[model samples]
Target: MEKYTGKSVLKGIAIGRIYWYRKQEYRVEKVETADSEAEKKRFADALETAKEQLSGLYEETLARVGEDHAMIFDIHKMLLEDGDYLDTVNGVLEEGFNAEYAVETAQNQFAELFASMEDEYMRARAADIRDVSKRVIRILAGIPEDGILADGPVIVAADDLTPSETVKMDKNKILAFVTAKGSSNSHTAILARSMNLPALVSTGISDWEAMDGKIGVVDGFGGEFLVEPEQELLDEMIHRKNQWVADLKALEQLKGKDNVTGDGRRIDVFANIGKVEDADGALEADAGGIGLFRSEFLYLGRDSFPTEEEQFISYKSVLEKMGDKKVVIRTLDIGADKKVDYFHLDEEDNPALGYRAIRICLDRPEIFMTQLRAIFRASAYGRVAIMFPMVVSVSEVKRIKEIVGQVKQDLSAEGHPMGEVELGIMVETPAAALISGDLAKEVDFFSIGTNDLTQYTLAVDRQNQKLEATCDTHHPAILELIRMTVENAHKEGIWAGICGELAADTDLTETFLSMGVDELSVSASSVLKVRKAVRDL
Candidate 1:
């Protein structure tokens, strides 16, 4: 028996045969061609074919994953149409090169350009270029795309999966996925979470060829994979798998039940969502409300800022879906790790500590007001609360309230009806937690964002995997901050909640209940488990 361990992002057990998957490689030879015009024409035909295929794939992906993920394919299409990319290909063909050779050369040049960037996000775009290039070259060389043609369920093992390939995978035939390389934030991991597929990454597997057709068990919960396991181990794994499924069934029954502790303490179990589409999942999970509706997604991957009406429609849809349930919509938290080209933000050595979130919104009130006006308009439909991100001072809170007042006044002058909306501040910085008493008086409630707070308090970059062990949210310091924030909120006749990953941690559920936390907002999948934890406690 052989055992391997890796990082597990999705928790489940998958037992199946191992299937080694690899993308077909198109060998590019620098063959001289006498007919340059003919080669150019061939390249153009391939481009046309590639465009059509990409458009169809984009639509399919949109139907499967949603617009945010489908945007990657659209970006791929744009890259194919880039002038520089075309010029490079045409230039190579003009130099008496074959169409395949010209396309490959141009793709490598652009890929290297992106791969050399210091920013990790930009560097990852290199894979997109390579994925698109492979498609076009395959068409030029008459090669079929790689995919699973297995007869039965299997665990797909690969070096890595591109966004396109990941989205297009046949879930029915694939029991789970294992990769030799990838991070938790990679497209593969994102898709696995969305699809609820058991997956393992960075397994350091160099001998995948010998493992094909071998039966294996993937323990996603433990981040382990066992190949040709002993009978005793296999029996234990099968028993665990059955228990997991039974637990899921039990969790489904817990929905619609009160989130009450054993001591009769009641708490609100909310959901943290990104897009309007997430409202359905939140509702399915029986969330008490949406504690953090990340409004930044509306501002991302677009050419310009979203108009007031556009934002209103999006917010209203979610609000209307959860009538009478509070929906906390955070204002645009741009800059830092999240950025838009039109914002024209300057590069900073330490963006996390630099201008971001409330800082940017304050400097750009016009943009801030646009979002506030939309939230107010949407409030007319149902319960809507506006929350500000990365706030560290009472002065910033006062200024935000003043701007909101101005927006309401302007909307009233224009004869537009608006509803009453509650204002809240996210306690993410140590300064915010320390001054929670002062800040609590300015808002209706406080939502502790432990993700950022842990980073700021520990002086550890959460993005740095090496320091992940050091950035402990369970540290006594973080718990004290939470305890203090809740105390301050109650003292000021307000409520305190946690809307970070910590809120979903089952082990911490009892601690939060004991701390008198008013609400716990977590991911949709985690809602039932958290509720069960509260009930058990």
Candidate 2:
């Protein structure tokens, strides 16, 4: 038996035969073209072809994984159209190089530039450029695009996978993914998490081809991959896999069940969504409501800020789909890691602690008011609530209330029909949690963003992989803060809920119940699992 340890992207167990993922390799020879103009035209034709392919992929991915994940293809299309990228390719072609060679040159130059970036997110975009370049080059070389093919379900092993490659494969045939090189921040990793697939990255498995068709066990919870395991180990893994499957089936049974503890304490279970289409998933998962509708998604992957009508249409669609279910839409929380070029935010040494979320909204009331007016306008369609992110003080909440009040009045004066909307703030910072007693009085409820709360309370950079060990979500300090926030919220006659990654942790479900947490909002897929945990407690 051979054992390899790596970082786990999602927690699950899979026992299957190994399938080595290999893409066709194209060697672009540096051939001087007699007709430079013709070569440039060929490159342009290939770029157009690549854009069309990406457009089709976008529609397919959108139907499969919804908008947030599908936006990756849109980004790829944008990169193809980017002026700098086009200029580099054209400059190479100007030197009388073949279209294929020019594309390879541009790919190398752009990939190197992105790989050298300081920000990890930008660095990951290097793979995206490489993917796009390869697609265009394949067209120039007249090679058919390749995708992973397996006879049956198998654990996919690869050096690394690009987002396009991951999405192109038949997900039903993929039992798990084991990559020798990848980051948790990679788009492929995010897609794996979204698909609820077991994935291991940075495994350093160079001889993956040799293990093709070999029985493999992926222990995502333990961050271990077993190859050609002994009978004893194989049996143990089989047992664990069976147990995992059983647990999932049991969770399915809890779908329509109330999120009530054994002692008869009932709590609301909701789902956090990024796009309007995600409301369907939440409802399918039996989520009582939408806890955190990340409104910033509307602002991303676009040229400029979303107009009032655009935001209103998006919000109204989600609200109408959700009907009377309370949909808590968070105001624009774009900053820090989530940056937009049009925002023109300055570079900061520590962006997590810099201008972000409510800070940006407060600093630019024009942007904040625009979103508020849209949310209020959508409120007429169905139940709606507005939540502010990164609020740290009662004064900030008060200012937000003033803006919200003015927005409501403006809409009323315009004779727009509106429904009652609840106002709340995300208690993410230590200052917000510690001052929850006062801050709670200013809002209708408190939604603790444990992801930021834990990071802020421990002074740990959550995005830094090196600090993963120190960024403990279940730390006593974090629990105490959650407890304090919930207590203060109840004291002020306002309910408190958790709407972070930690909220989905079944292990912490009982602890949150003990803290009197009124609600838990997790991913749509985790709703039933969390509900099962609550009921079991």
Candidate 3:
């Protein structure tokens, strides 16, 4: 029995046979072709065939995943039809290179270009190009496009799952996912989380092919994959899996129940969402509202900044889905860890403590106002609230409100009807928490971002694995800061809430309730569980 450890992004247990994934590989040889026109014709034929395949894949992916994710296949089809790709291949063909060699050269050149990009998402697109080119090459080489074929359910083992490849996969056949290379923030991990599939990423498993057809146990909770496990180990895992399923089934009963305490004290339980698709999960878990809609995801995978209409559409979708429920949208928190290329952010020695969040938005008012306009326009659809991140002083809040007022004026002049929107600021820094009383006077409510509050107060980088023990959100000092912030907000007649991971912490449920916290926003998956805890209180 061999066991391998990895980072587990999603928690679950899967016992299934291993199905090693390998892309169809073909070798190209440099050959002198007398008929250059014939070589060009062959290349064009292969490209057309690849385009057809991608069109079908796009439709399939749209049905499987949502349009946002399925757009990746559409992107691939565009790349194939690109004039650059065609001209490069045809140029190589005119240089006396065969069809296969020309295609290989063009693919390698474009793949290198994308791989060299600083943007991680753009860098990952190199794989998409290679995947598509491989299809064309296989057709040109007369090799069948052999995909991952398994007889029954299997745990897919791969180096990495591209956006194109992941969406094309059969969800029913894929019991779980184990990858040699991927991160919790990768597209594959995001897709896995959306599907509620067990996934173990960065497993560094190079011998996955050898484990084909062999029964393996994926212990997502333990972050390990057991290959050819002992009978006793398998039995224990099966029992644990059964228990987890039972717990999930039990949590289902908590859905649609009002998050009220035994003493009839009511508190709103909301979900922190990154994208519009998360609205479904929030509703499934019966969340009262969406507390934190991380607006950065809209800016992340794209080549340029999203337009006002684009942002408006996304915000409108989430607001419309939630209906009367509140949706607190955080304006572009782009800086520190979440960097964008077009923003051209300068290299800072310490980004967390340096310029980020409100700092960036404040400096770039054009960008900030565009986002504000979108949020205001979307407000017309449903209840929408705007929240600023990494705020420290009253001046920033005042300035933000000033800009929001200007945006409202601009929209109104354009004959756009505005909705009744509330403005809030995130108390993530110690400075913000200390002056919560003064800050509370300027906003509708307070949403304590405990993750940043803990990091900044403790002088610890939350992203650092080595200081994991030091970054304690449960520290008395941290709790006291939250207490002060919540107290200050209530004093000003503005409700306070916790939106960080600590909001869902059951151990602090009574503490938040005692502190007069009006709401707790956590992940969609934790809404029911947290609501259950709140009710039991």
Candidate 4:
């Protein structure tokens, strides 16, 4: 038996035969084209075909995974039309290269540019560029897009998978997925989570090809992969897989049940979502409300900032869908891992702790006010609360409140309808947690963003896979910070909630409840599981 462990994207277990996923390879050789115009025309035709394919894929993915994941195809389509990318491809064609060669050149150059970026999220974009370029190149070479083919259900092992490739796989044939390379933030990982598949990434398996057709066990909960397991281990893993399946079936029974402790203490179990379409999933999961609606999706994958009307339409859609449920939307938390080129952000050596989140909003109040106006306008439709991210000081909260007050007065003067909105700040930094008492007095509520809280407290970069063991969210310092923030918020007649990855961790669900946390917001899929934990406590 061979044992390997990696990062788990979802918690489950799968016992199946391994299916090595080797993507179709295309060799684009440089060919001297007599007519550069002909090659350019061919490239244009291929671009059109690629866009058509992406459109169909977008619709298909939208129906399967909802609009949030489907938007990746939209981004891919936008890249095909990007001027700089077109210029690079056309430049290669102008040098008398064939259409396929031109696309191949552009792919290598653009992929390298993104790969050299400081941020890990930006680095992941290299895969997108490669995926798009491959599509165009394949069309030029008269090759159909690739899809995984398996005779039966099997665990898929790949070096890595692009979002397009991940989406195109036949889900029915997939029992689990194991990859040699991927981050938790990768789109492939996101798709795996949305599909509720047992997945492990960054396994660093150099000889995965040799393990093809071998009996493999993917223990996603423990982040382990067993290859050609002994009878004893195989039986144990099969039993665990059965139990995992049973637990999922059991969790369904907890749906629509109140998240109350044995002592009759009720806690709000909310869901964190990025797009308005995700509200449907939240409702299906029976989330009490939305604890963290990330507002950044409005600004990402676009050439320019979203208009006030556009933002308002999205916010209002989600709010109206949730009806009377409280929806806490976090303002544009752009920067760091999430980058928008049109924002004209300066390059930083370390963006995670650099000029990001609230800093940008305060520096550019015009942009911030535009978003605030939209949220306030949408509030008239349903319960809405706005939270600022990466806030570290009382002065920042005061400034945000001052700006919000101005927005409210401006809207009132303009005769615009608005609602009673609650204001809050994300207690993600040590400074914010340490001075929770002072910060609590300025906001109506506090939501602990444990992802950043743990990272900042431990001085470890969460993106660094090598330091994963060190960046523990369960550290005593992080727990103490949560406790402090909750106590301070209660002292000021406000409430505290957790709106991070840790919120869904059932092991810590009781700990958070014990800390008097008013809410726990995780992904929509985790709502019932956390609710069960709370009820069990």
> TM-scores for all candidates?
0.72, 0.71, 0.76, 0.73
Give the candidate number with the greatest TM-score: 3
lDDT of each: 0.86, 0.86, 0.86, 0.88
Candidate 1 TM-score, true structure as reference: 0.72
Q: What is candidate 4's local distance difference test score?
A: 0.88
**Candidate 2 lDDT tens digits, 448-528:** 998789889999876566777888888999998999999999999999999988898889888888889999998787898
lDDT of 3 at 128: 81
Off-target runs (Cα >4 Å) in candidate 1 are 1-3, 15-36, 47-217, 226-239, 301-310, 339-342
After aligning candidate 3 to the native by TM-score, how far in Å is the CA of 84 from where it should be?
Answer: 9.7
Q: lDDT tens string, model 4, 421-445?
A: 9999999999999999999888899
Candidate 2 deviant stretches above 4 angstroms: 1-3, 14-36, 40-195, 201-217, 226-243, 301-304, 307-310
Q: Which regions in candidate 4 have their CA more than 4 angstroms from the true location?
A: 1-4, 14-34, 37-138, 141-177, 182-195, 206-217, 225-243, 410-415
RMSD of 3: 6.7
Report how far off residue 356 is in candidate 4 (Å): 1.4
Weakest lDDT window of 10 consecutive positions for candidate 1? 185-194
Q: What residue runs in model 3 are displaced by over 4 Å at the alpha carbon?
A: 5-11, 16-49, 52-215, 220-223, 230-236
**Global Cα lDDT for candidate 2:** 0.86
Compute the lDDT for candidate 1.
0.86
Give candidate 3's error at residue 112 in angstroms.
Answer: 20
Q: What is the lDDT of residue 510 in candidate 4?
A: 79
Rank order (by lDDT, best first): 4, 1, 2, 3
